[model samples]
Target chain A: MFRNIFVLFAASLFCFASCKKTTPLEFQPGDKGELEVEFDNVIGGVNLQLNTGSYTNASGETFKVSLLNYYISNIKLQNADGTTYTVPRDSSYFLIKEENPSQLITLRDIPAGNYTGISFVLGVDSLKSTAPVAERTGALDPAAAGAGMYWSWNSGYIFLKMEGPSDVATSGDKKFRYHIGGFGGFSTPMFNNIKQISLTAPGTSMAEVRKGKAEAPHIHIMADASKVMNGPMNISIATNTTVMVSPFSVNIANNYVSMFSIDHIHND
Target chain B: MINKKKSIRARLGITIAVIVALVSLGVACTKTSRQERKPMPLVLPSNFPAPIYNLSSNPITVEGFELGRKLFYDTKLSRDGTISCGSCHIQGSAFTHHGHDVSHGIEDRLGVRNSPPIMNLAWSQFFFWDGGVFNLDLQPIAPIENPVEMDEHIPNVIEKLKSDAQYPGLFYKAFGEGDITSSKMLMALSQFMLQCVSAESKYDKVVRKEGAVFSAEEQLGFDVFKAKCASCHSSDLFTDNKFHNNGLVPSMVNDSGRYRITLDPKDFYLFKTPSLRNIMKTAPYMHDGRFLNIDAVLDHYDHGVQVNSTLDTSLNKNGVVGIKLTVADRANLKAFLNTLTDDSFIRNPQLAEQ
Candidate 1:
């Protein structure tokens, strides 16, 4: 019985794949352009490089970025005609790690059109993040994803993970690690940690690519690392060093969410 | 006026016909839905509440469940390949460590608390004594990673499984891929655990109107239980699935129970009310397994309740501490609790190692 079911499932999958191949691609009479989303980590206008080993926060606490990674998803580009083109769900969510060679996120297959603004979710939505482990694939798969971002103790994907040694040390361990991500586990609304941010392009018309062409202008997004510890809540390393999923983690998450804004969009 | 009355009668007749048709259609649809889904082998007693487990996420397959059963008995999951899940949870004793007040793990390392029996886990929303782990799929992690328990890291276990010749094939058969994952392993274990339904007791037979009658003493005991214990141990499942401070004082061990998880003073000494399905067979009751048998448990309820701020308000009757029960009442209650023992469940060969 098991063998029969397996055979049928395999056959169905094959049929589905073949059907997709037979189907024609739906493309408008316009060039398919690529949008590059870049992240510039800085500290008070000074460029903040990862693993450089020393940087000070607004609270006079010096720290280093041993690891920094987060999820950016649900990207949408607004056209000049007020119409929006959304990035497909299957390949939308991107895991941005500082150590990765490609700091610039290249979103392909975007139809050539006059775009004004771009908006995206800073973290994976609850619907996908909270889905059963079996359903997830590729980058979203918890086991294959981040080294320390996924909580082994529970069913949750840590949205923002930052770990490094800090000067503020009251205990034996001087390392500061913040794993922030929680949605719908607690009754409080503040515990729902997914953040949504929008950035309006500085230019009136963001891009205009020629027909049958690729590679469009880049959207430069400068994310300041200093704001993470020194935003609305002045998080001191001596007291509040690490948070997994607590009220303090929520405050830290808020700071990280506010750190991103489109510096400028290059159309040239 | 006569024409208007006739028209109204016709409309009523049409409405009744439509309602009948809709009802029949709905029944037919339900029947087909049941057929399509292939009624779960895991028997969900008609009287029990809808299972908390989201079945659609990881539907139980015969091959998968069998694989899980094999893994449950296999000691490869442990550090030295000595202690398996079955080591603590023996089948004849309702899947609990019989005679042991507290559970010991790999290398005879003692754990802090008693190992609770595994039965009807489909209905359990929260797991463990403290109710710290909410998801059932994640519950195994607590035992697997506990230094005193299996003492095996997840990655190490996966590596071991990959090396094993049999496990790779089993994984492929169960999940359609040889790639063994922590998710798949956990889900397969859940599938096996979910099928451990213990509703074939004499009490269930009586409740099901199967011509089985309860003894007079049992009937009386049940009435007493309804009046006193039914609030926390509610319905056929015999659990309200809520945490309560039943006045078990925090010992020198400082086992604060639920408060350790929630970090709230109100939740101090609170523990998830365990289901009393096979309460008679599974001796050494309570989270710490302090009480030896039913008599000690009843005695505690009657007089030994420690008065504290977090004491369950229901147990406090008219400002009097503990429950008021006579010796006769205790005996009768014990008789009724014994009727909950399902002989068929404990002796089931399918659940045991082949």
Candidate 2:
């Protein structure tokens, strides 16, 4: 009886189907991507200028930037191939300031491949501005070391406010403080767009990056802070710096900040 | 022999059919259960636009909504566990701070902006009165992380939620993971907040013709509102979500309402017109909560409007006071605004208490 039962089971098994193929995950893991961004706070491409920024004519006060701080979120490094590596929404970006160069942003877990270029916003878009309280390191620090681009009263970020001082304002010289916000539609505050750059022979692979593929790929951005007051007001307000309280940046003229370059990411 | 073979084959066929049917039924039951376990069984009014917050990226589950409510009431959500969202946004007072113009938070901390009422917010395009914060999902972070409010960091709040055993279970039920994070925290809070729709108000019933009718005073006030304030504060949704410089110039500091956020000169003194669903309950109108009551707000619009270039075009009347109403008309409009107060919404057991 036992032999018969075994024989029957064996015969059934032979009649049954073969093994099913193992499936792969919807999200496949790829090689790692490395990136480096550099920034040059310079004056007319001559001096490696720091501690200088522009002012807005909203208050007509000249405020030479003593500090510059901003955020760059949703970073992406595009490979030469069709495939692109995007910085995850939850992590892999920075809110960097000029004061802290040692703690630059480095994105990992990227779909590592041969990459040519990178792109990122100078400030968080309005959508991300809604939840600006996500905590991380470096740019995520509440202390905001090296970055002076946040408003103390409003608690909102100055996405592209370049302030230092201007000789144009009336009532003697005044401190130019341009607070730029507005990420949500027309009235939101959180937008500063920097140009995008593509790195050449830029290998994101840790091994290739270590083996000297290219100067750690970074985009260079130069914002001339001196041009903050080159235009009309962004909002209605008193011209005197000591006079206006909640003034806003309205227009951009010769005094507006510029991206300068698109491909050369400033790493330092 | 033929009959025997036929019965054997028939039995095998019946067995296979039963097994397949049972298996499929199990899967179907599970799929139905999953559907039932969704966050909320509601959506915004049809007239509204697409929600700024995407639900797919951060899905809402019934568990998530419950957890959010628990967190909302829990004192632990605050820095010192002494103050919670309920401290300022009390259901009894219609979610706005009743006594103070500006909100008082942790350690008797004072917020610069008035603690605006929180209700029917799923339809709101902007969060703050100035429309600074865009999405509803991001609104809690302002209160939770503000130095004068919760005085806590996102990391610290996540840590606190992670340590709490109750929260872990609640979180697992809601999000399928016990490891608490700020995103999860924010998502959960949003689920709870979004479901805070005040559609069951008497005003809503009247609109639906559900045997609800306005009194003579309310009817007169309604007529007045349509005649005078209907341009900016439009039909159905109270506000058209447009901003206006209602001719208010602060004697103290020149605060350029929406202009502060956009840096645009045209939007000065313009604010996100607040929903008047519970306007009667939400006192101290405007961004700074300067006015004491709805009566004062009416008075401002009636006799005190100052004309300027950036003023809301809806209110301008060629140097004439925009939408001037008699003292009687103002009182009647105030009554109509009062009718918008949803007592049931404020007293709903599903939304209130710990």
Overall lDDT per candidate, in order of appearance: 0.79, 0.61
What is the docking quality class of candidate 1?
A: incorrect
List, residue by residue over A73-97, the lDDT tens digit for candidate 2.
6677665445566778777446555
In model 2 chain B, where is the ten-residue run with the lowest total lDDT? B46-55
Candidate 1 Cα outliers beyond 4 Å, as residue runs: A1-34, A40-52, A99-111, A114-116, A152-154, A186-190, A202-217, A263-268, B1-40, B78-83, B99-113, B130-134, B145-156, B251-268
lDDT of 2 at B66: 85
Best model per TM-score: 1
Q: Taking the tens digit of each residue's C-alpha lDDT, what string does model 1 give over B56-162? A: 78888777788889888989889999988989999899999988888999999988788888899989877888776666776776687778999887667878888
Clashes of each: 0, 47
Candidate 1 has a TM-score of 0.79
**Candidate 2 per-residue lDDT over residues B1-354, each given as its tens digit:** 999999999999999999999999889756654654564645665444555455566566777788888888888878888988878887877887876788888989776677877776656767676776655655676677678998876667777877877887677677763366665677788777777767666667777778989988889988888877777777577777767788876645566777775666787777777778788777877777889987778778877778888977767777677678887887788778887888887887777766
